[model samples]
Target: MFRFTDYGEEDAIRLCKELVRIESTDPGSYEGRISEYIYETLRQELGADGVRLCRSEVLTGRRNLLAELPGSSAPAGSGKEEPALVLICHMDTVVAGEGWSEETGGPFSAAERDGRIYGRGSCDMKSGLACALTAFCREAGERRLRQGEKAPEKYRTLRFIASVDEEDFMRGAERVIRDGWVSASDWVMDLEPTDGRIQNCHKGRVWFEAEAEGVTAHASMPEQGTDAILALSYFICALREEVAKLPEDERMGRTTITFGQITGGYRPYVVPDHAKVWIDLRTVPPTDSRMLRELLGRAERAATEKVPGSKFRILLTGDRQSIPPCPKSRLLQSLRQAVREATGEEAVVSLFPGYTDTAVIAGTLGNENCLSYGPGKLRLAHKPNEYVDISDIRRVMRVLRCLLREPLR
Candidate 1:
């Protein structure tokens, strides 16, 4: 059996700091450097034969890494096959925006203070990645040690995937699914900073860009032309009203909408000819494409009626469907058992408000056994002075060790 020790905890923390220092900021530095670092590190730990890197088809010059440990077969014609377990972590983080505290050095400093690791990706996820890596490598090493033993315990095949572009369009995950690296029967878990809770369901997401068009006019002739900015404002109000009518869930809460970005008039002296607003909708069940279309239609009609000659257009930029909750899943039961053995406490089940790579997997591949559970708080992700407690990483490592050591039916 592979056991986690004090030294292993220290090594996991160190690995997290190194990952944070690599600067894999999405839409900024990109994940090339960090991907290379992870590929090299896994290669060294698991050997070249056990690890492979695949270049992303969507993102240029970026790659995803996969490391595998094959499982032993059932003994003496028992006619039993072990299931495969995939551990997933994204190698990309959101851009290190402004508002960082000087005491933490910088956004990529990966500083340690009072048992916390501070950096851009520290809390959002690098800590989870470190824990998963440590657990996987330890198990692989133990399997190697038992090579010549007379009777070693049979275990499930284990695979660790480090994907790219998770903070953006999730192209890496799409590629992983397209390449058939993961099947619908395989158990998958994404380390997405769930604050140590197992998130069995995820909120659906849809990104929209609403454009309002009107004739531009000079400030002196206010009545000569319509204002697109005013029309957009009306559209926003109508959209909010429509969104508020959507159904709510007890676990996932009410469907929410956020105006991420808006642009209107160029100058105070002129009536703008065009205005656009980017909207994000986080939805729950019973909120499907037909409902979205109906809501937008109602909002557009209300806006155009209020502002005559002003046309409104809505575009669907992205859509990620929700994963319904599976409280009685075998994967959840296994994880709960692992948590009990590791921490002597019952596991908490919850719903993730935001979307994740596992959403892409479940949506695209119809995999219901996938879930997210890891170190750090989701609230601290993509924010200034993000940090993860060292103790949290250790706790997650313990849970992962217990999970890896057991057999998944």
Candidate 2:
């Protein structure tokens, strides 16, 4: 068993601050620089063979970093091997937009105040990344020190995956699964700033674009041409009414929809010929792509019937399935015990309201042994002047260290 001191809390905090200073915003640097930094850091500690970069096919220059610590073979004649544990953390952050107080020292300042580290991605997840990195490096270093000393205790293989593009499409996670880095039997965990809660499930997410086309007409002409903007507005109202009819889930609550972006007419003197809206839906169980398509079809028919010349179409942008709660999960039980041992407090099990890489990993592999547990609060993510408590980072490190020390079943 490994002690908490094996990975110093102070070291984890320092690494978190350093990571916060790097501007690895999504759609900006796109995790290129941060991936390189992590790759080089792990290579230095675990050697080049233990760490490698997997470039993303969808995004240029962006890559995922994988670091592995292989475990000893099971005892002779056991006829079974321990399942591997995959720890995932994304290296990208949402853009650090304008608004910030002077105390924050700008978006990439990595400033410290009130025992918290402030900057973009500090709370969203850089702190969790630091904890994972520290724990992995420390465990690898310890193993190296104990080489050739009798028979080492058997442990599960540990894989640390630093993915890119989690803030946008989760293309990095898709690539990781496609590349066979994670198996169906392996347990997956994403460090996604869950406020130290053990989140075993998350809501489904679907993003689609609705385009409405109509004939342009002069402002003085009434009923001469259908208004594309009015048609899309009618569709939006119809969709909301349809979604309101969906039954609410006990754990995940009701499915909700949000209009993220809308573009319509440019000038006031003319009726626009084209209009579009980007819709985001947070879905519950029993809601799949087929159901979504039907819902959109109904709404489109409603709009077309109301506006004679308007034609509507939908383009799906992204889809991520919801993960249901696993109350009897062995991984959940083990993690809860580790949390109790590390913090002397019971772990609170809840559903993560937002989607995470664990959702993609679990859904793609049909693996129920997946969860999210980490430092910082989810509310702080994607906001300016974001910060993570230093104590929270230390606590997560302690909990993760305890969990990693135990043998996987």
Candidate 3:
């Protein structure tokens, strides 16, 4: 019957494996290859004019792939036009760190075992991307069918955006918003792995560098130079104390600080004149970059004051704005209904503990009609032997199928 539901488990598994086989890691890496593959796939389905590869001028070789499919016209006498729906996915995965070896298979091998696909990006997001892409294509084909066989009116337009640089700065998502690729009426679904649940709220992230400056001197004359390392140590301690006082949220969790990296001193013989520590802060609502910066300023003032003749500078590295939990919206209601219809179970509504590109899509972009719902376990992301269950992939596809059919309903 040429039904959209024909896009099944095997298809999703195959597509996910193919995507995982390509190593699209972040930090000095680009999403050109993966974005091109997606563009070609959509072009083959909807012709060249329907798909486009948008490269960012700021990030060379990093690309954002976009595909659009127009929906059916409004029914006669109804005079109601459907709102557009945007399917969003990131094209980058965290760096595949050490621990991947031949014994466990390569990170990009995409090996199948125990009904799961083993690879670097499998659990983090590639499976979710595959499901979204396949569902979009399936619905596009249905819209192109003969007149008598067409379905009822759904969205005004279906737009799929595979954005780059999500694992790092989220500049790809910012570009999409700056370019005005979406509007207030468009509902955005960031297909990040949520294990099988639907996520309406998530924590935000702010990264900064704390630099401690001191005088340089020979190691033998330790008292002659203000030790930058010791000054930074004092700063770290003060930062710990400041973060401890922040309030906690039951769902979104508490604001926490992580000292990711530290660098100082040239050699053992010389007291370093400069030292810097990278701090990553995970903040809940009411705790944004500005508030966090103020806390850091306090820490810096306390530390530098304690260690006389030492100066500290707080530089913001990156920020993902925070938003409170959204009220009951049409998009969330439709997604919950889709999950219920597809899995025969009420969707589990919860908050995403970690950061996601949804922060940019919903918070920075000012598009409140956004949520994260997809396949794979959130715990498995950025870990060794990351994998996504094939059954989960199929379930996500089924939910998306229902979403495409009756988005507004």
TM-score of each predicted structure versus truth: 0.95, 0.94, 0.92
Off by over 4 Å in 3: 1-6, 48-58, 73-80, 101-103, 149-155, 407-409
Using TM-score as the measure, the top candidate is 1
- Which is superior by lDDT, 1 or 2? 2
**Sort by TM-score, best first: what order?**
1, 2, 3
Candidate 2, residue 72: Cα displacement in angstroms equals 1.2
Model 2: lDDT equals: 0.86
Q: Write the per-residue lDDT of candidate 1 for residues 1-409, one digit (tens) a residue.
A: 1223532778789989999998989888888888887766666676754444444444787788778887775542355756578898998899999999899999999999999999999987899888888888888888878877997778877888888889988888998898777888678899888887999899999888999999889989968888999999999999899999888887788889999999988799998889999999988888975688789889999989999999988899888988898877777889999999999999889998888888889888888888999999999999999999999998998888888877644
Poorest stretch of ten by lDDT in candidate 3: 49-58
- Worst lDDT 10-window in candidate 1: 1-10
lDDT per residue, candidate 3, 175-211, as tens digits? 8887776666678888888978888887788899989
Model 2's TM-score against the true structure: 0.94
lDDT of 1 at 100: 95
Candidate 2 at 212: error in angstroms? Answer: 0.7
Which of the numbered candidates is closest to the native, going by highest lDDT?
2
Better of 1 and 3 by TM-score: 1
- After TM-score superposition, the amount by which residue 400's alpha carbon in candidate 2 deviates from its true location, in angstroms, is 1.0
lDDT of 2 at 112: 97
